[model samples]
Target chain A: MQNDIILEATGLTKEFLGFVAVKDVNLRVRRHSIHALIGPNGAGKTTCFNLLTHFLVPTSGRIRFNGVDITGRSPAAIARMGLVRSFQISAVFPHLTVRDNVRVALQRPLRNSFQFWRSDSMLDRLNDRALALIEAVGLAPYAGLPAVELPYGRKRALEIATTLALEPEMLLLDEPMAGLAHEDIDRIAQLIRKVAADRTVLMVEHNMSVVADLSDTITVLARGEKLAEGPYAEVSKHPQVIEAYVGTGHG
Target chain B: MSTRNVGFLLLAVALVAPWVAYPVFLMTALCFALFACAFNLLIGYAGLMSFGHAMFFGLAGYVCGHAIKVWGWPPELAMLGGALAAGALGVVTGALAIRRQGIYFAMITLAFSQMVYFFCLQAPFTGGEDGLQGIPRSPMLGGLLPVHNDMVLYYVVLAIFLFGFGAIYRIIHSPFGQVLKAIRENEQRAVSLGYNADRYKLVAFILSATLAGLAGSLKAVVMQFATLTDVTAAMSGEVVLMALVGGIGTIFGPVVGAVIIITMQNYLAATGEWVLVIQGVIFVAIVLAFRKGIVGEIADRWRAYSAGSRK
Candidate 1:
């Protein structure tokens, strides 16, 4: 069972100018499970996500992916190791067309991203896959449009499509439904479920119903500390979890 | 018109330019145009505003001049040597400059260029304030074609410009160029997608510096002199202005910009200090009235019109 743990963090802590943002937190994500990290605002969900992806270094901790230490690896390095993250702000290349944005991501795994001498037509081979990913994210209609012109929901879809192009083994989605309307939330939730079919997924989401529906395992945080960990059926009924959510006005 | 047709039309115009205009003047404009195009690769495509690109242009001119005058290297070899030197300098400067981004990157490049300027000012080989003068235009292909004549030199300069410009065009349309654009649009997004944005930027810087060096080397041969004015900070500002006026992100924007600015300089030569004031006014007007630059504005309007027609 221990070998089944794909990504493990032990005693993760982050301090900013003598103020602790995340403190002595441990997290274990099992192979092919959808894990959710949910909490009220300023509960250090984003900070914890950054630490795992190496956007922010943990003050003291060890992170292991596939049983190898990646505590100090860069975001790019960790991403290359198949732990890709989507930004909370919908990190799509705004100036690029939807097809081009996906193609850029697909180019990374080909290891020819530095080959400046070759024509971009060489990457036309990726068009089929890129188009498929775009369609999967329901952005086929906007494939030719620059990402900047995409509606907010479609832009998030494009971001997911680009991230999917990386073929990551585990994905970290930071607030994947942030700022989404009800219909968009449903669509994106479905997209996330479809993508998680063959990979582990770790997410920080504020939407409780989405988290309840999608997460296979849930970890609740409060003020940078882990408050509860279990399935939604068990964790939702915990007294402290109820008190924390209600007290923090998250209810 | 199709993009390919537009490109062919531009190429045809360039082919006939030297015949219609003064060959020497046309060659000089082409040289500056190539220089501006090289500068555009960094600022326009890669989103790096190097405030000291003159270091590459000026230093390469000095090196090419030295190679021609002292070492008596062939014209091709001399220009190659100069471009290589500039590429080497780019590696050093880019490594340091890419450590910081945005305004800091610009400042670092500017500081490095200033240092090179002072070095050129005092260096024995650079001829101090007098510059490297009387550089001979050697014959090409082992004396198969003499380049002392302005007509013959124009062809040579034209060939070199086309090669450099074609290479830049190829680079911008490559998969690597796609990644560069992605980096420009969202560096963090590029990084998360497993790209080392700094490394990409450094490669772009080297390519740009090498091409700028090629332009400078050609300019030295055309004019038969490498002067301190080539290396000055003002030259850097001029390239920026050219890119801005033409359209920083457009393929032919810098070339158009170089043509306009160089033509203005030629026409306003008698106006002395007024040339600088007029350039300032043009810059202000372009920034306020046509923020997308001349070519960019035209491109936008063309797209809008075409879209409307489709409807």
Candidate 2:
């Protein structure tokens, strides 16, 4: 009775031209779970992420988030419904400072996103929250720095901080630990652990250690299809998942 | 100096300028400055490079001309009518153009602009090739103020330009401006943050178009004619040139750009058609020499110099 899944995708499929990119994949992300979607390089994990987040329309599938069908929603509308996705390559607003980047997300809830008539000083109220989120991701020192000037690893942190500012119910991270330094990886892992305390996290992560350490459930995909699903320990030992990774030299 | 002080200084300069310069020329440049500023709001702030903005400016001019000449409307009412008509056009064209990205967006806008131009060419109100001529410079606010005096009209034009420029300045610095910057910088990221990016883009496009219309309305009143030349594709390119030369994103960049380009064209008028050649050369030179634009480059240098001095 306690198992109320937050996101449910059934028969999700996507085709580009004549080739199928993501085929008949079903995924369910539970409430407040650290779910890691893992697979080899050519896996349809990215496509699947796009479909669930409404960044790409599924070729044929129904996606129900919070038990409501959200098949045709715009990405922004989907995000407003509390499902936010971070881009694969850090999606920081390059010209804006770290604080302003977070503020962009915080201002969404204000709904005056187009109050061009009013002065910007009204937005000063959001500064404290923006700064807090900046600090939450250990970006307080670089808070004044333009996001373009931030180091590669720090941009990822800023991206997460911005997503956090939205107070999303579910945060879908596309390759969160992709290009981080070893130290950054651990810190981000800690941050993810902290973030998942109150919200659901469904991340497509390449780092197996982070996957093993953080995920409550792991879903593996290979060649545009779900190969296996379960806890990391159990799925890592699955013959198909092992063959999928080892077969592609991602072992 | 603070932005507030700078704004006041610019205002003082504008007030004093018409006395020193030719009032007609000054008013003309002021109208174009406002036009360029409105254009910059899209390209500079919103990162929407619209190549069809002449549609708004020219359309408003014709509308204002018709209102004043045919309807016998006051200048104030005519200007308002022109700007509102342009704003309405923006709503339609903006909805069509904002969804597209990069070149496609530019093309859509340009196409819409061409459509507007053709409409103006055939529309009985525009007088086709002859243009709407001998338009009277009407009084302001139903005889509250006389604007028939060239000098008085100069001030009126200055006021209109200032209002438009101030509105643009406020928009850029507002919460809405912050969101526009976000959308401009990374649209996908903005959307991911629950921003309806297209809606914001459409709003920005409309604002730009409306302000451009205001500029056109002012120009028609000041010049006493709404010509086919005003609505041409080349006019659209001229605004872009002004913004690029002055400073694409910086306040007062487009004004400076408009002044410089307009002055050059006025002075080079003796060169006949070669004035266009000189403009093209300057545009290319500016583009090549200062990629960040004149104001942007100067600001960068100033920052570096001040930082060095501090050291």
Candidate 3:
């Protein structure tokens, strides 16, 4: 394992009754790099994210973040430690203005949790930071709009901005470009590059082109077990990864 | 109309309404206004449906009644004492009840409130069926002036109602309140945002319950008694009806709902059980035919019209 490792999972396992959703999986994420996890449907990509982020406790295995043993910690605790995940669904307060949504997300890191009486100006600096991020993700035009009224693609972009507001050292993005238009995919792909410049990025994506374009390394899973792990070019040509993709196409 | 402006207008009308009508009726409206507004805090903003608010209300009344009649404390101190006591209960109950979400949360709170009701019925301090009677209102602060004057008491209650309403207004606009709204929309996301969502919800519940306690304690002082009527499940149902009829989520909706219901109760006092049946019909009508209630429907229509015209 590298000394600069940001996230490490060793023998991570999860089971629902008799069914094993994820079993004996090992993942290592380096600091300041985009690592993509690709797999077929129901191949436990999401379950792995859930286990790593503590949204779901592992039936067995261990997760380490920034050298801390965070296997059984709550989601809130893990997030506070700068490990955050963006949802597959847009997770935002639809009734709140977009600016307020990001502002609240930033407020958590400032240690001002109970200062309800302070004016928004106390958060003016944070709001500025959020606005800059919103613009960075191509959402400046919808800054004042309620999140619910935004188009689906825009909402997904907003979710990324909100997650970034948490100031995480590592981001676990679950299918960030799953249902976006091609142009939007290119736009978010660029945004992901800008984000990966300063943070460790581990993403679950089904878009093979995006995986090949963005990932410094790729890990492929089939039936809750690692089939291949290497550079994107290397993994794409690997016999096991190719067979998993092709076999599933025929199966 | 905006909620703050509507709330102010109602306060203006309430302050003077007593001059033309019976003092007791106006006072009754004021108490229920605070009650409804407090209940609205939980339902409207936090997206919590508490069918057990009357537990805080009646529990505060019982505490106030005991302090005044048995402990012989003055009225202001008595009410303050009751508010604090009820706030403590709110924290404990909220801590437990907020563990569940949606309908499960509602059922947990309602079940806990029923236990409180049974405690009141059998508790010696509650005076059972007879309740605590012949309680004194005394004077404000330290009997600085006579409270026997109904007009003076009316102004006192009005001031408290406005203060509570203003507090609710401030909270909903505050960042903490925004987080509560976030939790209501999506708990999983709020948690991932590093918010202790459960702690925020519990705080909201305690604040609402404490204010509801203030209303209940004031009622005990005004009426000079605490009775089983205050603690009954029917009182809980009535407040929920008020929130539903006015608009569950809007700030002023509860006050509007309360005034309407109180006025109806006063005029139809002679109608016997038909009053219960009539109220039920209104609740059903509001839920089935007009899901937005009075204020919500108007707001929705206004938003639609504005959006359409802008296009």
Candidate 4:
């Protein structure tokens, strides 16, 4: 039923200087699900993520989220609608304390964006919630640290905490497990599992083990076209996916 | 110790200093301090370099001058009118200027400000060569205080300066201010996290311009005159120098820069054209050796030494 759709893209196309990055693509993300988008490099996965989240306007096609058409919306508007994205890079206010970073993220949804007239104590309650999110993400110890001063892995955790503060119904994570050490990836995988308990998480991951372990559903693409879609075990054995990954030796 | 403690100490000194210093000189420093602090809002906190801010300053001055002289408006109303007009101008100019980024943004604002300067030059109300002269200083708010008393006017200017400076400090500490700093540090990251960076920038621009206008409007009242010279590119350069010399990002730096520069200007009033040369050298020195300026360098030193001692 249409009610199951959290996000849907129909006939989406993207081009850069006449070079086709995505062509005649269709995708859908179901409600309250962990959907993994896996592909080789230049598979247009990142471009697709950008298009769906309103970071980049599609050349043509329509995107609907939460049963409403969201084409041509600003990223901020889309996010305000409870659709949020964490960047491939650490997307945090590095100069601010971790608690402040989460508070800034929460400020948008709280409609406290321009409350310059209000006293600081009125906002302390918001920081308490931010601290709770920080603790849930195991960042309680680093909560007072400036985002930039924290270790690399901690910054990523802070980014997740900040994103969660937006109270998104759906989260688009771009390479959440990338560049993480094996042990750190396990921790991040556990965090993603915890986050996924409440919200729909659509993540683009290169790590096959993470994709296998966390995803309820997996979609594989090679060269901008859908190769296969299923649970992880089925897709891992798909001939085209195996051929794509085996020959490239990069993903 | 803490900058807040130091700020309070300075505030106390400023409140009591009319006995020791010339009222005119003290008032000039106060006006310049407010102006510098307002200018720092965009550059220091928002990471926006607005080369066209002098347009706001000059426009407000001219508007206040016209309102007082032609419309015969009260002093408070005239200053408010000036600030409102400048805020309106800021909205338009900021929308256009913010379409560009980095050095291009700076150039766009500079170009737009220069347009305001040319408009003032040809506009008939500005009085062209002589400017609006022999302008009367209106009475204090609601005609409560006599206009002719020097120390009373000095205190009024100081109060306004303090109010403006306090507003800036509060804004910087607010959540909105933190987001602005985030946008300044990494705009793409801010966008990815769902902030409308352009909107934040425009709001900051308007706020900065309106406050700068308030400074100019007060200046017109203090000097009891408005001139084309106030809107000139040199005035723009001078405010930037003050911010740079005091500290580009710190709260107290610009005020320090403004006070020091005003003091220098008074002492060098007897010398011909030396103030400009001296200020220019200070700018070079700030950019070259003291990129943090007087306040930033001191703050950095204190932070570093404190951390070191704690360790």
Highest DockQ scorer? 2
Q: Label model 2 with its docking quality class.
A: high
Give the alpha carbon lDDT tens digit for every residue of B132-250 in model 4.
77668778676897766888888888888888888888888776776788888778767766789999899889989999999988888888888888788888888988999999989
Question: Model 1 misses residue A60 by how many Å?
Answer: 1.2
The local lDDT score (0 to 100) that residue B114 gets in candidate 1 is 99
Give the Cα error of residue A144 in candidate 2, in Å. 1.1
Which residue pairs does candidate 4 place in steric collision? Answer: none
- Choose the strongest candidate by lDDT: 1
- lDDT tens string, model 3, A118-167? 54456677778889989988899999999999988888889989988887
Superposition error at B53 for model 3 (Å): 1.2
In model 4, state the lDDT of residue A10: 93
For residue A29, model 3's alpha carbon misses the true position, in angstroms, by 0.5
In terms of docking quality, how is candidate 4 classified?
acceptable
The TM-scores, one per candidate, come to 0.98, 0.98, 0.96, 0.95
TM-score on 0 to 1 scale for chain A of candidate 4: 0.95
**What is candidate 1's lDDT per residue for B1-311, written digit by digit as tens?**
56678778988998888789999889989999999999999999999999999999999999999999999999899999999999999999999999999999999999999999999999989999999999998887799879998888888888899999999998999888999999999999999988988899999999999999999999998999999999999999999999999999898899999999999999999999999999999999999999989989988899899999999
Error of 4 at B224 (Å): 2.0
Per-prediction CA RMSD (Å): 1.6, 1.6, 1.9, 2.3
Per-residue lDDT tens digits for candidate 1, residues A1-251, read: 78899999999999999999999999999999999998888999999999999999899999999999999988889999999999999898998999999999999888887888989999999999999999999899889999999989999999999998999999999999999989999999999999999999999999999999999999999889999999999899988888877874654
Stretch of 10 with least lDDT, candidate 4 chain B: B133-142
Collision pairs in model 3 = B44-B249
Q: Could you give candidate 3's per-residue lDDT for residues B1-311 as a string of tens digits?
A: 56567656866787778789988788888888899999999989888999889999999999998998889898888999888888999998999999998889988888988998999999988988888788877777776858899988888878877788888877777767777888888889999988888888999999999999999998998888988888777898899999999888877778779988998888898999999889888889888976877888888898899889999
